[model samples]
Target: MATSRGEFSSSFGFIMAAAGSAIGLGNIWGFPTQTAQNGGAAFVLVYLVLAFVIGYPLLMAEFIIGRHSRSNPVGAYRAISGGKPFVPVGYFGIIVAGLILSFYSILAGWMVAYAVEPFFKLIGADDMAAWTVNQGNLSRNILFTSIFYLLTIGIIIGGVKSGIEKWSSRLMPTLIFMMILLTIYVLTLSGASDGLKVYLLPDFNKITDAQLILSALGQSFFSLSLGVGTMLVYGSYIANKENLVKLGVFVTLADIAIAFLAGLLIIPAMYVAANTGTEIFDEGGNLISGPTLVFQILPELFNSMGAIGVPAALVFFILMSIAALTSSISMLEVPVSYAVDTRNLQRKASTWVIGGFFWAISIILVIYFDKLFGLVVSFTTQYSQPLLGLVICIFIGWVMNRNSVLEELKKGNPEVANSLFMKVWPFFVRIVSPLLIVIVFLQSLNVF
Candidate 1:
C-alpha cells in the first residue's frame, strides 16, 4: 500500500514545494532578528554573499542527487555515493528533519495563536499588555500549543499531492499577493521615510562583529532550508526534464527577496511606530527577540498608522498565517514522504501518523516544558541542525564520485560538465564545504 514514487504534476508544483520549504518561519521571523542584530544593511550584504557561495551550489547538488537517484534522502545518499563510507550521512537527514519539525511545530503553533489574537482583543492596546505580561504563563501557552498540533495533523492527513501540494499552491500565491499589498500600505504611512531609512541605511561600523557575520550566514542557510534534507527530499520528486539549475536559482532568489522585503516592511513600521528614534539594538545589547518583534512591535506600528491600523493589522496577520501554513506543509512533507517511501505505508496513514507524532510532541514542548523554549532553541541550533548539516555536506563533498556527480550536474545545464564553474564547484564540495561546516560546528559549540 505504499505510495508510488510520484512525479510532480508540473514544474510549477515542484517550485512551489521547494520554495515553500525555503520560505518558512526562519525567513519570516529568524531573518529579521539576524538583520536587526547584525546592523541591517551590512548583515544583508554578508547574507547575500553566503547565499551565493555556500548555499546556492549545495542546493544544486541536492537536486542533482535527488533526480538522479529518484529516492528519499536516505536511499538517495546510499545510491549516489554507491559503496562509499559516507552513506550514513543519509540518516543525518532523517535525524535533523525529525528534531527540527518537533520544535518547529511549537513555533508554528505560536503563529496560529497570533493569527487568532484579534478575536479575544489580545492584540489591541491595554489588552496587549495583559497578553505580553502573561506570555510565559503555563496554562495559556499550553492551550495555544495544543491548537498548533491539531492544525498540523489536520493538514498532514491530506497526503502529499492532495494535502501538502494543494495547500502550498493555494497559500504561496496568496502570501505573495498579500505581502505586496501590505508593503504598499506600509510605504504610504506619514513616517515611512524615517522607517525606510532605519531599514535600508547601512551602518558598517556596527556590523563588523564576527558574531553578526556568523548570524547572517546561519540565517541564509536556515532560511533556504539548505542544511536539512528539505531540498533533497524536494529534489526526489523532480521530473528529469525540468531545468534544475534554473529552478534552484529561481527558488533561491524568491526566498531571499521575500526575506529582504519582510525586513523593509517591518523596520520601516518599527521606526514610524516608535515616533522617537528607538535605537534598533536593545539597551542590554541583545537584539530584539522574534516574538517581541512581531507581536509587540507590529501592533505598535499598526496603532501609529491612524484609522488604517485595524484593517492593516488584520491583513498583516492574515498574510503571516498564509506564509506560515505554506512553509508548514513543506516541513510535514519530509516525514510523510519518508514513511511512504521507506516503510511501505499508505499515504494517508503515513501522513496522519507522522503529523500526529509531531503534534503530540509539540504539545509537550509548549505545555509541559514551556520554561525550556530556550533549550529547544539551543538544541536545534547549537546541536541538532549543525551536526546533521555537517555530515551531509561532507558526504556530498568527499564521498560521492566525481565522475557520477559531474554527469548528474551536466544533465540540467550542459555547460556545468565542462565549464570553469564546474571546476570550482567540486573543489568547494570536497574541501571548502566540509571545512566551513566544521568551523561553524566548533563555533556553535565554543570548541575553538
Candidate 2:
C-alpha cells in the first residue's frame, strides 16, 4: 500500500482551499446567470436550501470517504469498497476532472487576457465589438491558454501545502475584498436600484416554474464543485480534527456568499449600463447570458463609467483571474495527487506529464471552440456531472460499510455521529440525494 499522503497543515487552510475549489466561474458567472433567469431571489432561496439539503451532505460523504481512505478519488473508492466492482466510479470521477480542467483552463485564459487588456491600451477602443472580436483571435487564445496551464502546473509541482493551500489562502481573501469594494462602487451608480430589486426581491409567480427549481438545483450542485472529484481530492487533504459537517457548512456558505456578491455587482452594473443607453439586454428583453454578459456586456457597462471604468474593469478581470486560478489549481491537483499516490511518480514529474497533456487539449479547445466547446460543455455539465454525483452518493450510501462511514464522521465530530444528522444523512444520500440528482439529470436531458 502507498504511504499516507500529506495532510493540510491547518483547518483554516483546508477550508480556504476547499472553498477556492467551490467558488470558481461557476459562482462568478454561472450562478448569477442562473439567478437572473430563474427569478433572482426566488432562485437564490431555492439554491440555498438545496445547497444544504443536497450539497452539504454529499460534501460530507466525499469527506468521509477521502479521510477514511487517506487517498485520491480512485484509491479512496477502492479502499472504501474493498476493491469491489465499484472502483470504476472513481475512474469516472478522474476522467470528469480531466475533461473539466481542459475546458476550464481555456476560459481562465480568457480572463487572464482580459485582466491585462487595460495595460495593453485595448480597453480604450472606440469600437468595443471590434475589440472583443480581436481579443478572441485564435493565436491570442492559444497563447493565454498555454500561460494559464503553465501557472496551474507550476503550482501543482510545489505540492499541496506550498502550492494550493498557500495560494488559496491568499487569493480567496483578495477575491472577497475586491468583490466587496466593487459592490459598493456599483451600488452608487444611477438605476442600480432597479437591478437590486430584481435580484433581491422574490417573484412568487416565476418560482412555481419547474424549470426554475431544476436550474437552482443544478447550479447549487455544480457551484459546490461536487461531481468533479474536486471535493473528494480536497477532502483527502483535510485533517481528522476538523469537523466535516461544520466545514462543509462554512464552505457552502462562503461559496454562496461570493456568488451572491457577484450578482450585486453584475446586475446593478447592467442596469447602470442601460441607464446610459447601452443595450444591456437582448432583443427579447432577457438579460444577456454567457460570454456576452462577461466580455461584452460588462465591458460596455464599465466603459460607461468614463475614466473610472479603466481601473474598475482591471479590478474586475483580475478578480476573475484569481477565481479561475483558485479552481484550476484544485482541478489540476486531483490528477496530480492520483499520479503521485497511485503511480509512484514524483510531484514535479507528475505535474509536468499530466499538465503537458491537458495543455495540448486546452489548445484544441481554444482553437476549435466554435466547433467543440458547446458540445463538450453540454455533455460534461448535463450528462457526466450528474451521473458522477449520483454514483458517489450511491457508493457512500449503499456500497461502503455504514459502520465505516459513521467511524469517519466520529473522527471529525463524535457528537454528529450520534445525532439526527447521522440518522438522516445516509438515508438522504441513498434515497433523497440520488433521486434529486436523477431529476436534475433528466431535466438536463429534457426528459421531464
Candidate 3:
C-alpha cells in the first residue's frame, strides 16, 4: 500500500482523482438549486467567470504548494512557511475536510437509500409529494453511513496508485458517460428547451448581485475541492515534473462542464414537467435543499417522462451516488493518509480509525443534529471554505517564491508567447483572488 506520499501512476490518474474530487453532489444537487435561487442563465454566466478567474488561480496555487512541499497539508505548511503562522491553515483544511465528511456521509447515505428504494418499491407510493416524507429510520441512516465509510476506507487502504487513482479512473468515466446519456434523454422531452433556456441564457443582472457572487465563490471552491487540502493532498502525490497549469485547467473545465450539463438535465426537465419558476429558487427553501431535490422535485420531473421515468431516475441517482462516493473517498483519504504519514499508523488501521470517528460523528448529525447539518454545511460553503482558500491563495501568491512555482508550471508548455503570467496571474493571485474571496467571505458572514 502506498503511504501518505504515494505517487500516482500517470498524469491521467492524477487528473481522474483531482476531477473526481471536484465532481460530487455539488454538481448534481447543489448547482441546480443555486441556479434556481439566483435565476438560471444569469447565475450560470457569473459562476463561469468566477470558475475561470478566481477559481483557476487558486487551483494553481494549491498545485504549487503540494508539488513543491511534496508532503501532506500539515507538513507542507511547515516546510513552506518555515514555522510561519499559516501552519494552522493546513490543519484547518484537515479538520474541515473530516468535519465535512462527518455530515457529508449522511447525504451519501441518503443517496444509497434512494438509489435502492425504487427496486424495493419503497418509493413506489402513489403520491410523489407524500413519498418525499421520511421513510429513512435513524438507525438505517447510520448503518448505511457506516457502510459508505467502510467502502471508502477499503479503497483508501489499498494505496494511491492502486486505490485513489485506479478506482477514480474507473468510476469518474462511468459517471461522465452516464451523465451524457441522461442529457440525451432529457433533450428529447417535450419541454426540454425551457430548461435549456433557463440554464444557458446570459442574465447578467441576476448573477452579478453580491450574494450570488458569494454563493458562486463557495460553489467554485467546493467544486474544485480546493479549500480543504483535498487538492493540496492530491497534489502532494504527483511528481515534480508534472504540468500543474495544464492539469489545473483540465480539472477545472471538467468540473464546470459537468456542473453545467447537470443543470441542462435537471432544470429543463423540471421546467418542462413541473413548470418550476423563480419562487422555487429561493435559498434555504425546501425545493432546493437535501433530499427534497433528488427525492421530491426530481421525481415530479421524471414522472412527466412517462414509464421511462422510473429507470431514468434510478440511473440518475446511481450516477450521483457514484459521484458522491468518488468525492467522499478523497475526503476520507486526507485524514487517513495524514495519520499514516505523521503517526506511523498502518493503512487499514488509519482508515478505520478516521473513518469510524467520522462515521460516528455523522450518525449524530443525521439522528440528533439534522438542523445542525445545515449550519455546518453553510459554514463550510460560506465561511470556512473561502477562508481556507484565501490562505491558500496567499501562500501561493506571496509565500512560495515565484521563480520556483513558475518553473514547475513551465515544464510542459515552454512556449509562453503572449501569456498573462507577468500581468494578470500575479495580480490575480496576489490581489484579485484574495480580495474577491475576502469580500465574499465577509458577505457570507453578513459582516459587511
Give the Cα lDDT of each candidate. Answer: 0.70, 0.83, 0.77
Cα lDDT tens digits, model 2, 1-448, are 3235677787788888888899998688778767887898999999899888888878888887778887888888777655467677778778778888999988888888777777655435535434433655887788788889988888878787888888889899999999999999999999999989888888878877898998888887888888878888888888878888888888888888889999998888888888988887788877887777888888888888888987898999999999999999988888888898888889998999998988888888777888988877887888998898998888888788888887777787888766888788878899989999999999888898
Model 1, 1-448: lDDT tens digits are: 2135676666777777778778876677677667766777888888888776667777877777777777677777666645345555666566556667777766665666666655455345657534623556666566666666566666667755666667667777877788888888777766777667656777899777888777776776667776667787778777666777788888888888888888777766666666644444477875465777776777767666656775787678777766766666666667777777767788777777777776666667766565765786687667766666666666666666777777766665767766766777777656765666666777778775
Model 3: ten consecutive residues of lowest lDDT: 126-135
- Which runs of model 1 end up more than 4 angstroms from their true locations? 1-3, 83-88, 119-143, 154-157, 204-209, 276-281, 285-287, 304-307
lDDT of 1 at 171: 76
Candidate 3 local lDDT, 215-316, one digit each (tens) = 787677667887888888888788756767778889899899888878877776666655533233435453354466676777667565567876887788
TM-score of each: 0.88, 0.95, 0.89
- Evaluate model 2: give its TM-score: 0.95
Error of model 1, residue 211, in angstroms: 3.2
User: What TM-score quantifies how close candidate 1 is to the native fold?
Assistant: 0.88
lDDT of 2 at 90: 77
